[model samples]
Target chain A: MSASDPAGAAAGAPAVAIEQLRKSYGPITALDGASISVDTGEIFGLVGPNGAGKTTLIKAICGILKPDSGSVSVLGLDAARERHAVRRRLGYMPQTPALYEDLSPRENLVFFGRGFRTSGLSDRIRDVLEFVELWERRDDPLHNFSGGMKQRASLACALLRDPELLILDEPTAGVDPTLKQNFWRRFRELKERGRTIFVTTNMMDEALHCDRVAVIRAGSVLITETPEAIRARGRTRVTLGLRDGSLREQEVLAYEEEMPRLLAAYGLSDEVARISVRRPSLEDVVLGMIAGDAGAGEKPAHGGAHGGAHGGRTTGAHPGAGADAEDGGNV
Target chain B: MFSNINAIAVRINRQFLRDRRFLGLSLIVPVLLMLLLKYVLDSLPGLARLGVHISDYAILVAAYLVHFLAYVLSTIVLVRDRKDGTLGRMFVYGYRRREIVLGYVGGYSTIAAVQTALVLILTKYLFDINLAPDLIAVVLTMLALAVVSVGLGVFISNFARNEGQVFPFIPLVIVPTALLSGIAIPIDELPRVLQWCSYLIPLRYAVSVLDGVLNQHRSFFSELGPFLTLVAVGAGLLATASLTLRERE
Candidate 1:
């Protein structure tokens, strides 16, 4: 956010850059030419429904899966060719628990800490456990932990190294709302410290917390832009109530220039008893893209060469260039 | 690499110690089986004309039983870790395949050592077997067998899909190999083909080395060939295991 901005720290090298990544299993294509770039110190969110290839993309970036034909570079190093080096700079929290239920949280941290060869491991573990608010239950075996507690412990494992980039896959799934809020706060704090975070979530509301969001569906990223840009893809809806108990709703562009003309056209400028205007949420924006893609009968070349080229150097892009907001259905 | 291996080894040891059922199975079950064998052999009416010493047979059987136990324990632990994604998580954390394999070997080898010592001590005092003068040779032979068992367990775990798959391997691998290793009869006394097949079994060398020290009173130097063969087989199996291990199936 300032002179120490991670985006400016390395002018040319993006924190994560993927181009034309494709992966498959037999006949099922898990990822189809998905490409995106996450800038340094940015909280980039991958928002999509289940089976949208969010996990696949995260795995490819973490070097856990080798893409069939693509290039993935983390911190300017090839992820597949230089896996260990890339992994050393990353902390990944998998979708599943992927933990030793038999071992205590403290023991789990010790095991993973040694794998990363972390220095001052004890202090780091304690710090992360406290940060996740799991320090009091650190000695309990993970089997005894609730779903959210297990998730926090898993996050603590990734945080032990204080990595330069953290890749989390659905970190807030099944987590209580309070803990979910805490996680976002911690992510923001990490961003302030110049660490980048790449996270995936199906919860549309969660996208608001990220600096940028990539809307993916069925293995293809539909659009990648800032949260504000995504929200702007939906028009503001105005609800009008008449004196006779009749109700009518209308959609208008977000700009104020259209408001008065629309009100006059409805002949409700003086007769309207009540009026309310609300903008579309992220869910609306994603649903609009999905519906548009379905109607076009052709997949929007989301994050292709142009998207990739633009995404590489810029943090904010106009929503019109990607998905047309006027085409988005009524809010 | 060394530190990662050491950490994994320590973690594995703690897991084994915490699992009371596994501890009992690995340590107590074999001794109990040895006791049952001792009683059964003692009950049999055998004269001096037969020239079969029940105590010597007890030592051989005890060694084989303990060796097989080590195999089962190590395979179950390794396979469980793989199935649960713990090993995969470690890989994502930058731990290499060989480090994980070596960690397993180092950890289970500790269990093997304790197992060998416990079984030998229990059999020696419980059955009053005359094993004092050549105790070190016998212990060395058992320790060698333990190493081979650990290696075999880790290698076999790669082929198993789950814990249930591991059980079938015992009859297919351990039982046949133990039978051919002359646990019941001399390999040379079998037919020529069977005798030749015994050469392929590492346990044959282990049984031979143990027999020489405990029954034949041979020096460790005299049985050095079989001992070295055990160590070499262990190294080979471990290398293969490490190469076969993958993050996913």
Candidate 2:
């Protein structure tokens, strides 16, 4: 991360800026004033559990759904007012498979190409099809395509215009492991071409490859940080990974107060790695915070102007947010 | 707006052309239904008494074929895309909701016009029904009726969620509209409220327009009012359908 890197400047350029985005369906608050920014060419990930408002936020940005309050700007244009311009610059791959099953992949590409107002369309079509490795099956009816193949064609259609920003919602869901790896590799290739990608996912390992990420849950974004920073939340949790059957009883005893010194006395530090007592993962961090609040029958021990702003929970302002390692629990 | 409209037009055309079975049905189904109606009506004594005039039957055939094709196919196509996610993707791709509605209506109207023309020609030459009021008024009426039927199709598409749900609306909309339009029934003999419905149904004017063109000594304007009515109904339905496009399914 160079301080003034070109990519950094682009990432900081505010290709997409959301300020206090709020949406609701009667009583269900879909987006509770969530705010995030993406740089011009960075691949930013929005990872969260189900019903976390990722889809709602994406829909609002795409101009499919109207936000109740707050603002969304894409590439310096307001999404609601300049929807056409925003659509021209952005390519969206919806979570569901949206292609016409009766049409061949080539036909589908041609239709979408004409929609994007692209030139040299046939050549571009062949190029994108080849790029996605779906050229071999271009003539097959989409109804005949397997899930992975359909997804590839869907992506090919989205890339027809060489869009500046790509918003893919769970692009690899249900894809096999090998194809999933290929998909991520293709995403990296796209990033190298100076394209900004905004993706939503729940898989944490993939988050490691993202330049930055926002971990959201239940319509609220919990944290936004790099994978390294998130993992560094505490000293780093070390798992014992003990000899399978041999550790069950010991694992139960390790939770006991007297066992820490006893395990140290065993001289098993090499085989038995010490648990550094770190905060759980981004996923676990969110679940744990919510769980702790539920158990304590109180708020997250954090409440201030910024602490609970926009219906989101933030760390307390007093005592320096409790050393930044207090696991966000009042207990 | 026009580019987005053109995009949807191209998609609808490509979609119809790609499916051989659907294309065949689009071309053949209405003609077959016209022939089936002729046979069903000939068996009844009352319709048989309209002088057994080949020309009257031919005009009715032309009207029904145009009405059926416009109403049935448009609803099916629109509802199918809505059920799938293609409509949603199109919205994301810079297509204004109004363009989508207009595009489909325009495309379907074009197909219905061509098909109606062929049916009229077949009835005139092959079935020996005379063309009395020239080709121009007949063409105008067919086009108006087609637009009206397509409008009804667009309106119904908004309410259908899936293919299975779509077929039921066909009877609910098409049957009553067809029956009340005076295509299969005589409007004068019906009750007063039923007569008012005939005014509401665009096909009533369609049938009237056809009867005027085919029946000798009956001035086309005597039925000109119906032709104008069909056009007005179509425009009204189309406007309402366009407004509904702004809503998400």
Candidate 3:
């Protein structure tokens, strides 16, 4: 279900619920009235470009940041007021690899586990290291590990507490594709074990693995929908390669009706060397939404011209409407 | 809270153990300085004439060296933790700010204890420096100086953005405090205005307490004023450091 679905809200309290969180660094508003909800036992992806407030939102939800206004609740506890209790149930891995360069993976786990007051830490450390496939080299200092290995080690630290809600920021940014695939597999495995995952990433491909994705830009959430729903908003594009090494593209909402017309218009002529239909991906939908939002003159909600002293007015666009129209052209 | 402090302390100690060069340097600098002082004093004609025995200066120098080393080590480690996101990571893990500060204290204080003991033993055997009849008082005084150093280090670390920024603090904070705290010259020999300024430097109280214990053979209770002042200043600096700690901008 979408974050805004009333039925989902009625079913039970979400694992995380942020309402109009506003935070600013002088003139730069990091989070401008940002809001979203993540259901329990679901993997929620916050997809955004750099400076899109994804990290800020994650920090607020994790109780690392105190919003200037509004409220944040994690597992029905106020994140800002009841921070210690909320933090106990949440595991957070920051965007940067936060492991000590001189310490081994096991040592890092031991430190974090003790900080979280976890028991049977030695066994848990071994299990997490093995899960991340770093068991063989867990004894080596983190400085000797490759970027992917460091990322995996950081993930192991986050999992040391066996938290019910895991918040990971760009967990696979520098990781190899194979390791990224493995990380996703592990995330899915954790989900099956009744855990809720909130992850942030700029990679559109990564969002496909999440149960729901929130498209954030300019410190505002553009839309929240399932991967399939977001893809549905994207239209199929027909591209024709010409002999002159140039290409002509037409986006079609109804492939059956528009495909015939476009083919007939172009005909089986020598000028058109090849014609292919390309289905829209999540990238297209997200880009289309951002373009549409920009065209609509939506000021950056966080830390832009309208973000600071004046205070941003809530400008909630109809979620997914502009994206659907922009993607399908005539849907 | 204790568990969190212990865990962080263990992690910090492990990091120190892994960097053997730093550990070695921290332990050896004071000994080298003490040896250098011995040779210099033996050659100088005015030391005996001035009634300034090398033994009297040895305890003072040892106290100052231990304080300086503790300050440098704690500042570097804390600033590195800040720059590298370790401090932020611990904050995310639900560690209170005071606990993290205490963890640094616990870790560095352990090293300080070792360094103090080694310096005391080395001064006695290697330097042939005469010790006070009450060795425990001398040890307690040096440990207090170490605490002051750790507090000052952690406090100064908050102002430093990176490791490079930490260097300027040596000249601006350490050098002036070392010179003014009567480590090199007695406070009575300083200019009247400078003597007044030394009161503001916490190390002055530490040196005073050490002198009282080592040179005078005074018990801890006899040097209560300076001892309490040293402890108070260290506690004040640590409190400020904890209050200023923040995870992010």
Candidate 4:
């Protein structure tokens, strides 16, 4: 495989590398020795809960926020001292919508395009707007656009100069699911075009799209691995669904040593379903780790944003539970 | 550097055209204030209890308008941009903090220069106010006033959290400067203590420079000390503003 090719699994030179990053906001530590590297053309995902220092880390790398101690290098340039050159090669979409709301989408794109000093900027603006599929509404006031459209426009503005690196913070948080799917497709297309991207998302399912995932908690990274690696290390998960749905709540309440036995007595066997509980999901893994849950086998309930069961096909059961055992709520 | 400057100018002008309130301040507010200045200067004979020509007040008003326009409008626009995150956004896009400051100066300076032209043209042609001895000196003084006003705007914007906080500071700077800068209340008649207080205002130096240039027709160098002093004050404020940007970083 060629050096520039992104398809190869082996890591080449990292496009962006950070080491021993430390930052603090008064008494609260924002990043504690957080380090990660994004290889050339790889679409990396930084996964973490809120206040997990994801933004802090991104800001430090972007030179907008300074870390108390650490080093960040982008494409082999110092992030702090060489910020302008680094910025020249990167497109950043902040968590908050940073476009001028009063300006039309076209005007906003042109404005940011000018900032990047892109040659044939007007044409580049047109191409980016079309790429984001927002060309038709280019003349619409940004304030009038819906959340998803506004996000697409923001993406367009960031892509005005087609920088090599893209840093997006929850780029699809408020976007509708259909548009989000489209966004992921666009991200893959950009990845194919040899652009490196570092994205932060709380959406667990989106983790599957990333080449690698770094799960962070509090002010430190919990783990970083490929999606398959994370899933392969996944412990047993037996999501019990009761006919009445009331017994499941009580079973969760009596969840110490008794819940497992109760689950097994009802034919919820380990050989069949990999019982004895397991390490929680990406979200639970971080929260449980924060709560000092020891990463041991514990069937922590999944909540927050994933209220749906089975890919939007909703069922009247506790969230994320897949099993249906009716005889006095098997497990 | 120039390309960066062009980018900043585009953003500033885009903002100027898009925000209705800013547009009004840039175009209409200055014209209206010119008329108001004409009226107030016309009424000064009766109000001041001193025999002062509307023409004399007109010269002072021309100079003061430069100050007023620079202070009021620059404060509003700069403060709005800061509160709305435009200043922070500017830094993210390869712009030096100094470039942002100077680009705003360049954009607002263009606005002030054009408005100064109209005010002077109206005062000379429409109002029949005779030309002063040193027209270039007067123009340079007005330019200095513009610089001082914009510098003060950037300085004040650093402290203002939002548009609401910015509004209250307008009176804090404008009221005292107007009263003491020989615009309304002549500085000579005020007590010695208040006279010293007036000296602290950058506009006081601006008005003195204009007074020497237009009223006395002195060479610009005759009033060079105060002119350069005002420039220094403006530069000091701008430097402070650039330093405070570290907080945002």
Q: Which one wins on lDDT?
A: 3
How displaced is residue B12 in candidate 1, in Å? Answer: 1.6
lDDT of 4 by residue, B160-213 (tens): 777788888888887888788877888999999889998778878877877776
Candidate with maximal DockQ: 3
Question: Model 1: runs farther than 4 Å from truth?
Answer: A1-9, A26-28, A228-266, A270-331, B43-51, B190-196, B247-249
lDDT of 1 by residue, A138-238 (tens): 98888889999999999998887888899999998988655765687778778778888999998765665678889888788889998767666667676
The residue-by-residue lDDT of candidate 3 on A173-263, one tens digit each, is 8886557657877888787777889999987666756889999888888899986567656676768788899998988764434555677
Docking class of 2: medium
- The complex in candidate 4 yields a DockQ of 0.46
In candidate 4 the C-alpha lDDT for residue A141 amounts to: 82
TM-score of chain B of each: 0.94, 0.89, 0.93, 0.87
What pairs collide in candidate 4?
none
Cα-based TM-score, every candidate: 0.81, 0.77, 0.82, 0.75
Tens digit per residue, CA lDDT, model 1, B100-154: 8889888988988887787788788766887888888788778778777877898
Candidate 2 C-alpha lDDT tens digits along B7-107: 67767777677788887877887677666655665567674575665556667767776887788888877877776778878877656667888888778
Cα deviation in Å at residue A248, candidate 4? Answer: 9.1
> By the lDDT metric, which is better: model 2 or model 3?
3
Could you report the DockQ of all the candidates, in the order they appear?
0.56, 0.53, 0.60, 0.46
Give each model's whole-structure lDDT.
0.77, 0.71, 0.78, 0.71
Per-residue alpha-carbon lDDT of candidate 4 for residues A82-143, written as tens digits (9 for 90 to 100): 87777787888877667888888888777666665667877787888899988898888888
